[model samples]
Target: MTERKRVIQTGWNLENSYARLPKSFFNIIKPNPVSSPKLIILNYSLATSLGLNGQALQSNDGIAVLAGNQVPKGTLPLAQAYAGHQFGHFTMLGDGRAMLIGEQVMPSGERVDIQLKGSGKTPYSRGGDGRAALGPMLREYIISEAMHALGIGTTRSLAVVTTGEFVVRENQQLGAIMTRVAASHLRVGTFQYVSKWGTAMDLRALADYTLQRHFPAVDAGGNQYLFLLREVIKRQATLIAKWQLIGFIHGVMNTDNMAISGETIDYGPCAFMDTYDPETVFSSIDIHGRYAYGNQPHIAEWNLARFAETLLPLLHVNQDQAVKLAQEAISDFTKLYHYNWLTGMRAKLGIFNEEVQDEELIEGLLSLMQKYHSDYTNTFLSLTFDTRWDVALFGSTEFAHWYELWQERLGRQKEQKASSHQLMRSSNPALIPRNHQVEAALEAAVKQGDYSVMERLLDVLKDPYAHSTEQIDYATLPAISNRPYRTFCGT
Candidate 1:
């Protein structure tokens, strides 16, 4: 196919995803339209990666598709069916407000689900308006793109479109739709959705289909079921570790929000920590700190248990036998998550081999950071700089004491001693999407119709570890009055 053909919609062969499913699992429906549509942000890189036209995706035709203006040919826009345990409570939640517009098979032979979040309701809408507010839409667009740039596996925002209408949140806010592209929209909750109302045959069919589509190699070995769980565990471990290393708080860790692919999915009320606090909580809904910074690892384990419960019936014949197998598999989460987290943390601090005292050495630095309330991203970035002068940013005399231990620890490792430090410097970013910067970018867009700042922020974030004198200002944390930033649901 020629380059231009990539932008054209060819109707999907639904048999690949929908043909094998029982009708009770999903209610097929078209997307509901909003009042008016206007493009907010276009992720051309993500579009091009999926063998889509970068030019067309940024064009009116592409924006129309993203804004739910025109359902592309061969697409089936339906809100997926799934049930999730929200904040430890089981709730019958289905897409709620998001609608999936069929799937795309990429040049690399990967099938991706192209979904429009905030594209209005379905039978799953419950009692809501099926709309998304402008703030959260823009937030997902910025953060998801930023995460992708960081080399962490994450859903990409193909486009963000304003509905040119208002919705009631804390107050009236503009409505918008986010074109979210992902490996698959299948979540652990999807299994729960099917299992709750589906028969044994239906659940088995869903499991078999998932194995074929996402874990095909396992299917050939007659261990597809076990293999699928293993793969999901590894992905979630690595994904959660990446988030923690970068000081990202997912804010909500509901079972329904967990992606089977393990990429970071929902971006609601999510925020990066300006100051490293294990107890940091950003979501307005997380009033009791259920999904706090330090609690994520445990929460991920909890979610995996929910996933295990849904898969138990398919794992073994008897309930006790099934529970035994599920528990054995779920138990791997802690070691896997900590291994990934510790290894990444070691690299960030320039350590390699584990020492009996290394745990203290690492924990000591974090304690110092908490004592001084240091900027998590910046402190790590500064360590990768030429000299250790920037260590003062930690705001503690103890920081100097800790640096001595760090330097001594570095003496034991031989990977990059001097040169690898440069590599580490590059791997560690000097800038992130600061809460203030994102807010400023949105303010510029909403008030003045200017996206120049947003574009500029994306540019800086793309080369996060580089030292750009021109954009050095973007590297600094805002003053206290400017910080403790709070995000909203945006309806």
Candidate 2:
């Protein structure tokens, strides 16, 4: 077989619509240069989407750009300023170690923010070394790409490069940088920053610009700020529902990490649940279990409440009336969330028609899973195949009772069995970025300098719903020894 040659482009087209914002919004800071920069991996598909040549991005000059040693022409690199509530404590937090290189306007006219993560220290370093270790950077690359392949909205890793530097954490480790692509870096915390520090004029400008950029389709005649709040709530409702359906847990869901664009932004300390448990908490820092698996919907509501407060001034002339308006919008979060969540659950169960009893039926399965400590992904995948793991719940009288009811319900739908089966298969993935599997890959890469595991994991994750006998091992639950696994924040 002839070896296929890789394509290379020598030029880049970068724009800076975000840089056009007032200087108060961000700091014009350059990345702290790294030593011995070397290319590690390039996301060829993502590069192509952004009109970048993948082969060039892996070259020497590209390594310099990725390592923050050189800035590409037409790029305005800067660190964004934002405040967030971390572990319920309000504090000022910015890009400490990351910088936005610029935005790329693709041929489709969609603009994406290109940022370098773990580049180096910035003004917001907060008396800490603003550098990233290789393991965490690679973790983000693996999980984010997996999320994208699963059809979830998320910031993507465009490339990863080694800095040939060392960072001290629990131990000394090699440093690295990851290039991230997102719709925009605007977050609920971005509004919080302007509201708490910037002037009312600044707040207004930010609101107007956000509308122009993200919600241009929103009707401008009425209260646009309120419209923005409603839209954000709707997107978050849908997003969180998807998260729950997939058994994914975002371990650190602080306000700053919640992107206003509705994409899953920060991937630090996130994991996919193996066993079904409502109160599962993985982040080592989540001592209080504030951001648990079941708490996600509630925390999402809480974050939206904080976002609503920032828009109160723009909501109405009278503070009292604005409060009332914001409260009304916030009230819709539960209804919207439950509707989206139940609808997704129905699809996962292969139910084409919804009835009043659907929610009860869905909750029953979840309750049984929790009670039996069943594997989350396998339980759903079993149902898709018209079979059950005999060990989990299939043999239980209660589950059999529920199964009878489910069968009757499925019979009522006009859709054929094959159609419903297809829906169930697509709705429930056969694979996820499992915590144990991810750790194994990271250990191989960081300790043995073996990236083959990471590459193989990515190959299976790219088609999460497919059934491949050779890759069936990826679908199995982790062993008991790997139980109660904890994830840590990248910082």
Best candidate according to lDDT? 2
Write down the worst ten-residue block by lDDT for model 1.
7-16
**Once model 2 is optimally superposed onto the true structure by TM-score, how far is the C-alpha of residue 33 displaced, in angstroms?**
1.4
Q: Compared with the true structure, what per-residue lDDT tens digits does model 1 show for residues 1-491?
A: 53235345422222137533787777777757666688777776667667776666656666677777776665666767889888888878887788777777776768888888888877888998888887788788889888987888888888888988887876787888988888887888888888788888988898887877777667464546667777888889999999999899988888888999888998888888988899999888888999999999999988888888888888878889988888889899999998898888787877767777877887998887787777887778777774443445444678768887888888877766776586667667777889889989988876687889988988887767666775578877776784456776665
Models 1 onward score TM values of: 0.93, 0.97
Q: List the residue pairs that clash in candidate 2.
A: none
lDDT of each: 0.79, 0.88
The ten-residue window of minimal lDDT in model 2 covers 1-10
Candidate 2 local lDDT, residue 209 = 86
Give model 2's TM-score versus the native structure: 0.97
